[model samples]
Target: MNPISIVLVRPRDPNNIGACARAMGNFGLSDLRVVDPYEPVWRESVSAVGVNDIMQQAKRCATLDEALQDTAFSMASTAIKNREIKQEIVPLPSLNERLQVAPEGRVALVFGNEKSGLSGEDIERCDVVLNIPTASKQPSINLAQAVILTCYELSRRPGFKAIRHPGQAPEAPTDAQKEIFISSADVLFEKSGFKTDFSSDQRKALLRHMLSRQGLSREQLFFLKKWADKLSSKLP
Candidate 1:
């Protein structure tokens, strides 16, 4: 099974998406998820060249959550260092080590559109954030180039292996499960009249970060959802 998944969010250029697929194919990686692409003609992109099979098999998703529904661990690719919300930033060179500690499941490397890297809200949805170090002369790398470099790193990394803990640890919750737990918590928050200065979006972002950083297991997620339901019932 392919351990890594490539996710492109809101890509504005069809050529870039095609090129990314080509890059993944070069590294023997085929799982591709395009989330809310801006252009609809990506399927016919000429840059895909001989790697049409990867493009043909790409999955189209309406949202990041859908793209990440089955992924247990996700990394948001961003060039921006400073942000409103804080997330653990992992540099490209150190990615192998980071992956070694990640939960045992399919991993996602999420990339935003060419115009903008990942937004604060998007980064919050991921387990961690990663960036390629480049010279100050040109800070932002091309979207396809970034994917190429990332794939190259993973392909060449010596002794790289996905983490496995067998029966000792429960499976990590999928993004879909995380969303369900978050939605239940949001309902409980609303019904309980939980007042805070942060906007609902910001609050959700923070909540997402909290859940991601902990690497909560599926059992923990179900327990939290149950707790939220019970507490919500008592509130109103």
Candidate 2:
């Protein structure tokens, strides 16, 4: 497997940082880097549970540039798409595809703050932008959940190869991919004249559950994105 590092920038929540450490360890990824963290809570390892060792060994840096210094490729994770960045804002599955074929070089998955997410400057530092894709009404996901979802999606791809029961079917959409598809669908909802005041996160969560049950594939995801784009273009 290629070397992959998880980089957190100005992370404000201690529990979320710890949970990210645990999530990394869950998928056999231990290289963690924190940039300009205000509290340094991850150093104490209080929230990581059995993966405290991973947190203990994580590196700390004074800036995002410093944290990503050794990485050959970097991806910025954000909830909102920053129009200023010229880099492609790829969905989670597209990222997985690239990682699967990437050479053995340092790769960093950069995450931003819990509330405002990565700034435009932060996104510019990355080669690509990764959006988890949530509903239009409430397009935010929890920080820890974002880490878990990203790590879990990467783990499901060929490079990570997470172990599974012999007869059990694989998970569909993975959590990250499902979020992108649902978010794409939400773009269509806006075009359909649906009210944007509803609980979109809850609705997307339900859609994710239903899609998981149906076992969606890569081709299906492409089709959905295309359909949504066509629908969104028809709107005023």
Candidate 2: tens digits of C-alpha lDDT, residues 111-184: 98897788889989898888887887777788778888898888877745553335745434556766788998
In model 1, pairs of residues that clash are: none
lDDT of 1 by residue, 1-236 (tens): 33999999999999999999988877767889999988888888999977898898899999999999999999998876456647788999998878888999999999989997887889999989888898867778899999999998897666544332246766899988888888888888899898999776787788899998998889988999999999999986
Score candidate 2 by TM-score against the native: 0.65
- TM-scores, all candidates, are 0.65, 0.65
Number of the top-ranking candidate, with lDDT as the measure: 1
Q: Whole-model Cα lDDT per candidate?
A: 0.87, 0.80
